[model samples]
Target: MDWLTRANRRIHRTLHARPANGWKPDRFRKMALPPIAPPGWWKALLRLPRDHYVRLFTRHSSVHPPAVGRCIEVAAAMGQVLVTCDGVGVARHARSWASHQTITDPEHTAAAAAARKASAATKPASVEVTELEERSLETNDRIFDVIDDGLSTGEGLA
Candidate 1:
C-alpha cells in the first residue's frame, strides 16, 4: 500500500481500538475505510480565491443572525460579570462593556467588511497572493499591545 493509504489505515485502526462513548460498532467499522478526497473540480474551485471562502462564510453568518446575536449576548454577559466581580462602578462598567461590545457587536461588522474590502483593493495586481504574512504580523502586534496594556494596568507580566 502507498504511504497515504497505510497512514489512513493506521489511523482507522487506532481510532477503532478505543471507541468513544456512544459510538456504534457499525459506524466504527465503516469509518475504517479511507476518506475519499474531494474531486479535482471541487479542489480547483477551492483553490480559486481564498477571500471568496472568507466572504462566503461571513455572508452565511449574516443569513444566520443567531450567531451574531449569541456573540453579542455572550460578550455582554462577560462584561457584566467582569464588572460585577471587580466591583467597578456604573461609568467604568459601561466603558468596559462598550469596549467588549466594540469587538463583538454586529454594528462593527460594517467596519470589518470595509476593512476587508480596502485590503483586497490594496493588493498588488501583478503579484500572486500567498499566505497573509501581514495579518500574522498584525496578530503579533496585537499580542504585544495586550501585554503592554496588562503591564501598564499593573496586571504583572510573567
Candidate 2:
C-alpha cells in the first residue's frame, strides 16, 4: 500500500542488484515475511487490508496481527484491548476492523485513557450491598462497642 514505499525500495535494491551467484529463493521468502514490528506497527498495519492479519486483543482494546498467534488464543474476553509494542502493551483501544473505519468501545476507551490520568483510577465501582447486610454491619458495630465498654468497665464478661 501507500505506506510500503520503503519496503518496496529495499526489495528493489536487493532483487535488482543481484549477487554474482544470483538470487536465493529462500532469501526472497525471508524478505517477504516481516520481523516483529517495533511497537506502533499495528497502527501502520491497520492501514493495510484486514485480510492480511489475524485480529487480536490486549487488556484495553482489539488489534490486528496479534503480538503472537497465542496472544489471541485466550477463551475469555472479546472486542477490546490495548496496543502493544515489543510484546509489552503501551496504549489502549477498542478493537474493530471494518474497511477504512475506526471502531472503539467508548466506555472502554474512556476507562483506558483514564488510566493515564491516575487520579481517575478509583476503587472498584460500588455494588449494591443487600439491605440486610447493611443493617447487619451497623448493628454489629454498635454491639461490639457495647461489649468493648463492658470489658473496660470490669462488668460482666462471662
Candidate 3:
C-alpha cells in the first residue's frame, strides 16, 4: 500500500537487521507473522470499508484485511507487541476473574437485628408529655381567640 513504505522500513530496521546472526531463517520466519497495530490506528482503520468513514468523508474507500495484516506483520518484526486488555499498558474496565464470597458474622448480624427490633419497639418517648401539653394549650388558646373574634359568631346565624 502507498502508506506502507515507512512501516516496512521500520520493520526492516527493528527485526531484520541482526548484526550477530545476520538475518537468520528462523528470525525471518518469526518476523513474517502479523503484528498488532497501534490501538488508535487499528480502531480508526477498522472503521474503513464501512459507512461511517464513507459518510464522513463523502467518498468511497475500500480496505482489505491483508493490508492491515501486513502492517501487523511489519510491527511484529519490529518487536512491537500488542498488549491485552489486562496488560499494564492497556486501559480496561474493572473485572474480577475469580468469584468473590461475602463474609457474614453471625454475632454482628444478631446484634444488628436486636438493635433494629429495640428501635422499632421504642415509641421515641412520646414527644415529652410537657411538650404535648404546651401544644394542646396553644391550640386551645387559638380556638378560644377565634371564637371570641366573632369569626365563629356566624355559626349561630347558620
Candidate 4:
C-alpha cells in the first residue's frame, strides 16, 4: 500500500502537470459508493427446489408405489441424493405417496408419449444374432481366391 502510494505520488500527470495524489483529494468526496446487492442474492448460487430431480419420460418409464421404495434405496446407496426412510426427495417422475396419484408434468408427458409412438412406428423389433464358430486361417483363402480371379479377368479396376 505504501509502495503504491509512493508510486502514485511520484508519477506526474501530463494534463494538470502534477502527481496523481494532487487530484485524489478533489475527486475522492465526489465518487459514489458501489451499489449494494438485493435481499437473497446468495439464493442464486444455490440449487433451486425444482433443480433437484431425476427426470424420466413417463410414457417409457412407469412408476408405482413399490418402485418409489426401490428408488429411495437406490438414492441412499448413491449418497448425494436427498433420501428419507419413507421416500426419495429427488426425481419428480414418481406418484405422490399420500394421494397415491401420479404427478407428471402434463406438457412433458404428452411430448414423451408422442415421441414414443413415433419411435415405435419406425423402430424394428429386437434382433437376435447367433454366434459363429471360430474358423481356421483357411477361411480367408476363399476371399483371396475371388480377388485373384477378379484381377486375372481385368474386372478388378475396369
TM-scores for every predicted model? 0.18, 0.19, 0.20, 0.21
Provide the lDDT at 102 for model 2.
43
**Whole-model lDDT values for every prediction:** 0.34, 0.43, 0.35, 0.41
Q: Write down the TM-score for model 4.
A: 0.21
lDDT of 3: 0.35
Tens digits of per-residue lDDT for model 3 on 1-158? 76555554453565565444544766777754458654431122122222111111232222222122222111011222221222222111222222342223344345546666887998876555453434665587586775644565656655
Ranking by lDDT: 2, 4, 3, 1
Clash count of each predicted structure: 0, 9, 2, 0
Per-residue lDDT tens digits for candidate 1, residues 6-26, read 554443554654333325766
Question: Which regions in candidate 3 have their CA more than 4 angstroms from the true location?
Answer: 1-101, 128-158
Question: Native-vs-model 2 lDDT?
Answer: 0.43
lDDT of 2 at 26: 57
In candidate 4, stretches whose alpha carbon ends up further than 4 angstroms from where it belongs are 1-102, 125-131, 134-158
Residue 75 local lDDT, model 2: 20
Per-residue lDDT tens digits for candidate 4, residues 9-112, read 55465645446657677787786766984443111112222222232222221222222323232121111222222444323333233333334455545555
Off by over 4 Å in 1: 1-104, 125-158
Q: Indicate the residue-level lDDT of 141 in model 3.
A: 59
